[model samples]
Target: MTCFAIARDDLTSPDVLDLLRLHLDEMHSWSPACKVHALPPEKLRAPDVTFYALRDGDRLAAVGALKVLGEGRGELKSMRAAPDYRGRGAGRALLEHLIAEARTRGLIWLGLETGRTVPFLPALRLYESHGFAESTGFGDYVPDEFSLCMELHL
Candidate 1:
């Protein structure tokens, strides 16, 4: 079974920290330094952001966060499933949890920024399967070749 919770200490746990590092490294490798927007663990701790961890037994399977952008909108941030947990539904579970949370919070739109490169194809497919469609940039972001924006209107 999959279990998820609002991560408090998990964000600081070694396993989770390692996953975050891997995520950031992958982002930077795929996009230019200025276009890499994955937030660090400390940044995910902001009051407007809600972070979560997905666990399987005693293992940390995945991590994701939602940052509240005012005006009935929210942004997905730092979503990553450990390599060992890929194909085990961890990423999908985390995405579903965030989507449900957004709906419950009265957010009318949920958006995300991800790489436009081949390495990001899997993630792009996942979001698209979950009803997210490609969209123009929003919030503090501007349209950039290295980044692709997607949104799901609730």
Candidate 2:
């Protein structure tokens, strides 16, 4: 499979928004606990929230972000690969890229909230495979029955 680097401009491009919406809606259908709360693309213009979109040829294949929450802590948000793009290593690439970016910025730890529901096993496994371990809640996120918190030490 031919995989290309994700370009910065594509992150908020109108063309890629549909791909992101599809991925997010799929998550909602599959796991209610895995909700995306980023204020729409309009509000994502801030410097603290960095978003990326990976493309395969002209097709948008995956997307992810690093949201700086201050105090050397960051949150991983909107990590998703198009349905047809799964298993092609795009997801893994985006994740590893984001993690390395976070480390480069001097973050001590990176955290994420995913579903504890039945449908999220694959996502949980991906995070664990990448060295993220179970962790206590950070940020405004609380310990909810339907969610699980995971973190990686840099």
Candidate 3:
């Protein structure tokens, strides 16, 4: 698929939210604990969160967001891809897009929180494959057995 990145404003468009809702529902169905944080549509308007939407033509197929946490650090959040687009490199595209965006913003490190469950193994692999390594919890995520933190130096 031909994919390109757009700002969070584009990703949070009404149509994009509908797609994200479906993605979240699918993840939730797989595991109740795999909760995708739901932000009011308005919350996505914040400048601190840099979101990238990968689209095929007019359809948004993947999305990922980077939240600046100061101290040359960034937190990855709200990463998901349309179910039909999985295994087609959409996830990797969105991730690499976000990593580039982070560096452009002067962030030296990028980190994220994901579940430690089996279903999240693929998610962990994606980050690991992209050069992210194990890291201590940062931002609002607390240290917990269920959470895995990974970071990559820019």
lDDT of each: 0.87, 0.78, 0.75
> What tens digits encode model 3's per-residue C-alpha lDDT throughout 69-151?
88998888778878777878888888888898889989999988777678778888999999998888776665466667788
Cα lDDT, model 3, residue 55: 80
Write candidate 2's Cα lDDT for 17-106 as tens digits: 877667667666765533434345544556888888888888878888888988898988878888788878888888999898999999
Error of model 3, residue 121, in angstroms: 1.4
Clashes of each: 0, 0, 0
Residue-by-residue lDDT tens digits, candidate 1, 1-154: 5554434343778888999999999888888999988999889989999888888778888899999999999999998999988877889988998999999999999999998888888899999999999999997676577889999999
TM-score of each: 0.93, 0.86, 0.84
RMSD of each: 1.8, 2.2, 2.5
- Cα error, candidate 3, residue 25 (Å): 3.1
lDDT of 1 at 119: 86
Model 3: CA > 4 A from native: 1-8, 26-40
